[model samples]
Target: DGVNYCTISLNQHIPQYCGSCWAHGATSALADRIKIARGAKGADVQLSVQHMLNCGNVGSCHGGTVDGPYQWIYKLGKRTGSGISYFTSQPYLACSSESRDGICKNADTSCKAENIARTCSTFGEPCVGLSEYPNATISDYGSIMGKNAMMKEIYNRGPISCGIDANPLLKYTTGVIRGWSLMQDHVVSVVGWGTDPEEGLYWIVRNSWGEYWGENGYVRVKSGALALERSCTWAVPDTYTAPEKNNEIHCYEGGENCKVSAKDESTAAAPATRKPELWKRDEVERRGFQWRGNSSTPSSHELLFTPSNGFPETFSWCDKDGKSYCTVSVNQHIPQYCGSCWAQGSMSALADRIKIARKAEGIDIQLSVQHLMNCGTAGTCQGGEPNAAYQWLKEISDKTGSGISYTTGQPYLACSKDSDAGFCKGVDFSCTAENVQRTCATFGKKCVGMAKYPNATVAKYGSIQGKDAMMKEIFNRGPIACNVDAVPILNYTGGIVTAKSKDTDHSISVVGWGTDDKLGFYWQVRNSWGEYWGEQGYFRVQSGALALEQDSCIWATPKDFTAPERVNLLHCYEDGSNCAAAVSATELVVCVIERPFAGSPACLRSPASGSSGMIGSMFQAGWGVCLERSVARTWESFKKPENHANNWEEAVSFWAVSFAHELAHFESPLHDRQHGRAMEMSQRAVLPGLARVLSKPWGSAVGSQNVVHRKWTLQGSGGNLLG
Candidate 1:
């Protein structure tokens, strides 16, 4: 009764801007009502406003009737049983049929199948439409006018969409709008009501603008202001597509693509959702986890196998083959206490799967929980969903062709939206490339963002429950992440935990199951609170203790990962200021030969002149490059007096560019002019600042020609550098 069933915030202006406030308002209200109808369990089901804009006869970016979308969805479900698609299937593109400007100019705003619900193998185009995507159907729709009816509808069901004045809200910021204009133009949803000490009674309203605007994406308006209480709309959500227990719906054909969208429990048989249960966080009870419930009848496969049916009496991925396939134990409380059990648990399970995928052969890879915390849609330090973490991982793999990085690449920094628990006090949680993964400078070099880094990817992932499903997944794959109560195990020393409470507030990975002589059956669970706590960062719980097996447990499959190798790896510039891309096939090995006198051609002399041709000689011996020290010294001597203070640093730059030019030959034909252009472009791509310095003419000190062609020889060392 005390649960907040409202879903996460939404913005109509992401990726691009759209003025579909009517559709956003209507769909959001209906989505909240659907969540309310489903008892707030499982991942929140967000309705797609884009879906409505494409098909809802009511709205566009320009505007439309607030009640029309509800009527349209209700009638669509009544007629065809397919009311609206989910936001996950058809994420917002902020385009509409009415507006042909901006992003909508080339967008497909039609009611085609792909336009309605599409999934892509990558982030870009060439997407296919699922013939049967999950949809939410509405039973009835109606409209009401006046304050009392609006309040009753919201309190009884959920939030209701309402209209409001346009001109006065243009400058509205953080307060209850109170004015005389009854002009109704913009539409918003009224979630609830509150009484301010100064403003008296006000309606808690949500806007289509992003969370950065007004009171966390909400603005309270004075009761009955601007005719906001004059007109309102509400819809009764009837049923939505949901997966059966221990199963998932494939969003695409062949059952090989991403899993279906999050499901709700409500249906024709179970019209009313489960009642809301309440739990709080405290010293003796630290429950911050959630179980995303499932619907539909269990499959025959689910009924065939129970936990003890043909299953081993005891099995553990940790001790399998006398080797621990799991990654090292982690501590979320270090640097500061972070409630990132969700990230730690899921990522650990995924890493263990990766290790198992490799047959526990090579290094036990540890995934970066910090990378997930930095870029994942899953909740943060306060609490979050482990299932959502896997879902987000798969989504990123689809978007960027990669998933989370290793812990060695992006170490843990327990940071999030609210909590600043330790070393993460001033961290940024933006999901940019640099924010996702970046390195700090060393040896006085400026920090450079890594354009390409190694990463692990997800092949498939989904939620599972019940002891049999958990055991089967663990026995087959490796380990799984699940929710726990955490209260009873706070001071646990050893032995099996038999706590009765199932109020899950923490997340931990279940590695395997075991049998105890006196304790009966128990789960071998791994915790993220460092190695010093409770059985060396692990504990055993009686099979179903704290709803360990019943709550949402997550499993992810590792597709492939970049092996950490040094072949063709990026090399640093001579001064360590920037990186020079490895553009050669084989590793470039250079040998430096210092000449005794300047302008002597010491490297080019023949045996006939009483000296062997060192350049010709080294080329015969198969060196990648021959660096003449006299030419380096000549460039140093030719430096301007103004550059004398940084002469040593300039010399380092000169040598780096010289090597860069010779390496450029491997990428192109052995032509001096083409190699020169390739070297110039490579310098600009790798280091723009240094490219500018090398582009300048040396003021007749080195005789007017560019230093690249004047001082540096452009020969391929033995012509083997290309290989």
Candidate 2:
């Protein structure tokens, strides 16, 4: 299943040598569990270890237990402030040389003004003030003593922090570490568990050491071998606060504030026709079944069917044959259970279709559900229409050339427990336009640029009615975004579900259809819930059941899918002396070159001859070249001469040779160590190539053109050449 889940990978490297495994293990596990609980909203949160190292009563550096960090986080509440901070906020600074095992530097111990000043200066941003920094409090924490219990907790929640004897692990570079040691010395977070064919079984444990330490800062330790299974702990975050519900405030159609109470019908009478509830059918229709979405209309493009010949025995884009035309199926749990399924379903379907149209090459394009959730004009966490989301995609694509961005560009942060209305507080959705503009200006760009195949217009999309129509569309095109009654399906773990219901509440993707011997026919559907909830983020629905075949189903075809071409352009300068001129010229060149090359290319001037220098380098470094100053000076000397033919010919020949040498450097930054023979050959080739071009005199005459050569003057130089 394509559920966008976040992983708890340790990004912070303990400075120099510090045995803060206790801090690292506890913080890592807590943060991972929080993100998982939030349905992996793509929020990168690294709980502060420096907070525990400096402030916690835990035995620092030498050794400590998982209980110390857990208790500290529980009491002080981990955050970026005096007591705690995010990894990016405070970062980790190894204890001072003067500070011994139990002793800590005064600066490391507390949030002093000098410490705050230093942090601000280092990061070039205002320190997360003592008051401004928010705390992540834990309601309760306990130890998972047994190995089975630890595995169960991790599977149910997320990672668990545990103690392990890490002396044998010091030299561990790779492979599953298998050794039994009850003398637990260090702590590490058990992120996940996996079994290797050769190595039997192992636990994916996260280490504090930098990425270069283990398997990218993680280790696969043998299961039940080390003391890791002996001790482990887990905690629950107190991030959930009940949403404020005001029954008196009646939100009318179009979300207008009518200011009238629900009981007062005399003011502005509630619409006689009940608006179709697009979310939480079981809850919305608690009293009686209410219509969801407009009455399903028969698809205009529906194929003429033969009653005698039913749908093909079984068909699925995703099957056992490994020949899947549909893009890799994905799942998206709107972080915090936000009721944006309408938007999620439409975006997921369209993005997947786009991928299939593009032949499922390279990077999988995950269109931003958050973009549709926050920026889209449909409904908010308070439910929305799937058609409205499709319409939003069309409108945004028209306005922004490229459709909405990928997930990383704009991540989903609107986390809410209530399916009725989502909470947008403490999210990217709260950023002001001015703040966004200022931040973008500071960073030198706004948004994640335009997408290559951004304009994904629904060529022809309509409600897919009946099982045959849905199956036909899936077999022909790709997956179809459809609504299903999920009230009973929430608790469903495996097997074909056959819940009888006409009320369609939740939106999901019908990727394919298949049949099982025991369960009969079924639809392999992908849900937005986390992978832990269903069969690895996918569930089989009983064919023709749950109002799936009767209700709304959208089939979209990606329009004009084409990959963007790559084009590299560089402006060659005579010498690297004109640094200011090169910088000014590059800014203009980027715009000019970007038109032809849809993707942004590096536009920089070559370094002056001889000296290897990076003169006109952009913030994002790219390849640069250095030309010989003598070559440029020689070309300049031939600008105005008594012998025009000789001088011009020599100038052109030298220019070509210099251009080839610099172009080679631009193309391949790594120098060819095959002596100067290759360079000599390239120089020799340039003259002949220019001679061949010059021989074709009429080649340039294809169009009516005037050959008016201007006298070359080196920029930033006072006098004319050869003066």
Cα deviation at 657, candidate 1, in Å, is 20
| Candidate 2, superposed: residue stretches over 4 Å from native | 1-311, 320-334, 415-423, 426-457, 560-723
Q: What's the lDDT for residue 222 in model 1?
A: 87
lDDT of 1 by residue, 137-194 (tens): 8887899988789888988989999998856655454668788665788889999998
> How many clashes in each structure?
3, 12
Model 2 global lDDT (CA atoms, 0 to 1)? 0.50
For residue 541, give model 1's deviation from the true position in Å. 19
Please report, in order, the local distance difference test score of every candidate based on alpha carbons: 0.60, 0.50
Instruction: Tell me the deviation in Å of residue 579 in model 2.
Output: 23
lDDT of 2 by residue, 419-504 (tens): 22122232234222111111010012222111121224555456657877777777667788898876666555566888888778
- Candidate with maximal TM-score: 1
